[model samples]
Target chain A: MLEFILARGNYWVIVALMMTGLYISFSAQNLIKRLVGLSVFQTSVFLFYITLGKVAGGTAPILIGEDLAGHHGAGHEEDAAHGTAAAGHEAPVETPAAPHVETEPVVEVDPETGEPIADPTAIDPAAELAPDAVDPGHSDIPPLQGEDASLMGEPLEDGVTETSDYVLSGHDGAADALHQAAESSLHSVYSNPLPHVLILTAIVVGVATLAVGLALIVRIREAYGTIEADEVRNIDIDVALEEEEAEDAAAEGAA
Target chain B: MNPDHHVILRVVAKTLIPLITLYAFYVQFHGDYSPGGGFQAGVIFAVGIILYALIFGVSSALRLIPPSFTRGLAAAGVLLYAGVGIWALFGGGNYLEYGALLDEPEGGHHGQHIGIILIELGVLFGVAGSMLTIFYAFAGRVAEISDEDW
Candidate 1:
């Protein structure tokens, strides 16, 4: 229970925000407060969309050149060959002054086993459960891939240092993942750009709708001399009562 | 004391508005590769103008961009979006079939590259103009920029 709950912390935060926004919109009597609630709800949706697009160790949807090693000369050549035109962005942040050594992505294939050379413990978890990723019986769950080809720990509460280890080994993992993809694509990802685009469009549309709602509120305030919903209701009731009384008086006079 | 003029606000707004506009354009153009795009850029642009209005008063802002112009801006944006689709049609494909927009048989997604930017432009105009138009309706009081004596 602890493993499941703590590992998936993001869902808890999203739920908290969603409930708060829902409560505010439903309970608020002030017109502005209700709008605020609506905005909060909209924000939750944005968060949800963004969360849906996030991959554990993925870059943005923008395709980097084929060389995950980011070997400056190598990536440049790859960019040219691929015709993707992404030039300056291929290297990691640490490599502004790094030497221009031309190197291919070096995944050491074992002389006998044909398995990739990597830390045994790092590969242990996924190696043990590798069949789960491919098995028909376990197909109901979305395939929880290792961050690379390894480090597929269940992310229980017991480990904090694993994250750092993963970071230190991330680039190696990327290259290895790409290399291994020729046989199997156990883990490699890019965040979905479709949702990114949708959110970009949605944010503007959200604001425009908010503005329309506020404009309506402004007009309401101008016409009714108050922005409170209950106050407006009172004014409406008073007008209806007066009209009814006037109609009754006119009927009596005709009789 | 000249309560009629907000010196600090005016100065601050004067300095910030230009930078905000510049950043908005940067975001607009860099949309494909970066985190920002047309919607965000449009909001930033609108925010710059809105900030100006809040500080210098709505009248000055209206003077800068008349309500008629803003209305036209909104309509023009919608038209631009449709216009791109029509242009694609002229290129001998269905609506918004961006691959047809360019004749480069060997060029990879050249049409998509241009089409996406143009659509982003349309979104920018549509969002910003509608935002300002709504603002004008509220702040200007019955769609009038300057209020006269009853």
Candidate 2:
């Protein structure tokens, strides 16, 4: 319920800004005052974008070294355990002295041995040719696998595939996660474009309005030697009365 | 305006504007990890300037930031924002796809941060200057008319 209220709060703020802008544009005689109102309205939208990007319990997606290491360790452990268990036998313990086997292709020669260091984990040979890949000239030594797991005494589960938790959540958790993911993705995609387009449109409209308002101010200055809104309105009223009298006299003369 | 009035208002404006602008920078820089961001901070900073203009007379504010400079700043901000999109395009990605800014697509977060900061700066200038400009335009007209009557 709290989340719902927070989510809708932005919409309410936008509505309020809209109403304020409308009121100021229609009722405020001062041209600059109207621009202020328009800006207030535009700002409310910026607020909306900032609010939408917020993720619950998610840190800024910035990956720190610790975070990267944690993820790498978890993934490596999971893969090694699963692979060994699927083989139906205890995997041979890897020793530090054993030279690592290369599983991937090498594109460069080692400076020391003048031999190409194979990339043990290169999934693609074409990727090996990429300039940014780790220099193939280094010793193609693969890290000892299962050594860490052996130290921990945790038998790595071989191919212990758990059923999708989505099915176990009895539909609610799965649905919620999916909904949240979709919303976040949508927000990410639209957050950039929406504000840019809206602000641009507001600016053009603002400029046009400002131009017209300035022109009116100029005209008011010429007619009454004053550009003040109050003075212009008073002068306009007097002129209307004179025109009305002139029109009445012309009609009487026609009669 | 009285000297005292000028002093008081200037003190207030200086105090508030810097604090608000600092907060804006904080939000813009930390946006990747927080609830605050460029757009929100920009508006707040603009409001702070508007408040300054309101407290001090329009003429005083104009002296601090001329109308022509404000207009130029506003335009420059928009140009900077569009330039980021253009940069992304040149970097071999779709428009605004900051990932393409560098050779490693995964390192695109850095590019995104740069793009966001540039866009936020644009928003800050445009909002603050235009708001101040509007205040000046109305206040000038009103002052001129009132003086004529006197």
Candidate 3:
């Protein structure tokens, strides 16, 4: 149970932040303080959304030319230019040691020209890759977390799953390991960008709400001469009472 | 807001403002290739303006971008978006179907690119203007808060 909680610690943080923000928002009497609390709550929601989009062994979903191998994000063109950089390398280990790739091409023939295409199967790197060996990084990951399981159908090796930093780690495994690592990096999962894009709009809306709420608070303070909710209510009550007394006097005069 | 109030801040802002604006534009344009897009870029641009207002009072900032202009910017942005959608309709496609804008068989991708750029541009203008307008509305007010309030 502890391991499960630890694995998804980000959720805990989101919950904590949400509760704290809610507490402050509900309990605070001052209008500005309430706004601050609301902002905090909004921030927690943003964190929650962004967290949901994250994948354990993912990169940004930018397409590198015709590779469709790994997503290279905008402005990070260098990432696609330098292949296998997604391997999370400590040094400049290019192509996960390119010469060691032991590729068995799946052959196909073109229908129209009757020409042979050289190994189009190489384009789809993830079709044959599977967890034949224990993936050390994901061995402890809870099976309940369908996030990782759905991606590679197993815990991946360092080149794909282990490195958070955009890649290259030289594992001096045999040629088979090298081949697996190279192919895996290209097919590595990407964090879902849909949530990220949606959250951007959410953030803007949050700010707009904050701005409008704060502006209303300022107007309230100007009119009521206090920022405290109770004080404003008390002032309103006093004015209502005075009006009632005046009405009573007028009725008495008419009588 | 006085010129002598914070010399250091003024100098730093003078140096940083241009870069911030440039970065906002970069984020807006390169949003397709990266994490950022219209909404993110719009917020960044607004932050730059808000930063300026923070250092040099609301009135000073308002001089640079009048409230009317911001309002116009917001309206124009919305109109631009609607205009593009209408244009697509004229091209005999569904509402906002960018591919219909061009007559070419292979024009779908190019049309999509253009449509997305225009939409993003609209979003940028609308968000930036609305944010600035809200900021101005709040900051233009003269609130008297005593030190005891703290």
C-alpha RMSD for every candidate: 12.6, 17.9, 12.8
Strongest candidate by TM-score: 3
Off by over 4 Å in 1: A57-190, A249-255, B1-9, B106-109, B142-150
How many Å off is the CA of A221 in candidate 3? 0.5
Candidate ranking under TM-score, highest first, comes to: 3, 1, 2
Per-chain TM-score, chain A, candidate 3: 0.51
Clash totals, every prediction: 0, 1, 12
- The reply for model 2, stretches above 4 Å from the true place, is A1-255, B5-14, B142-144, B147-150
Lowest-scoring 10 consecutive residues by lDDT in candidate 3 chain A?
A107-116
Encode model 3's per-residue lDDT on B1-150: one tens digit a residue. Answer: 356889999889988887888889999998755667777787789889988888877787889889898888888878877888888788775577666566436313566567778888888888888878887777765567642553
**After superposing candidate 3, which stretches have Cα over 4 Å from the reference?**
A57-189, A248-255, B1-5, B54-57, B143-150
Task: Give the TM-score of each candidate.
Answer: 0.63, 0.43, 0.64
Interface RMSD over true interface Cα atoms for each candidate = 9.2, 15.4, 13.0
Q: Which model, 1 or 2, shows the larger DockQ?
A: 1
Candidate 1 backbone collisions, by pair: none
Say what the interface RMSD of candidate 1 is: 9.2
Best by lDDT: 3
Q: What is the Å distance of residue B48 in model 2 from its true position?
A: 3.3
Indicate whether candidate 1 or candidate 3 has the larger lDDT: 3
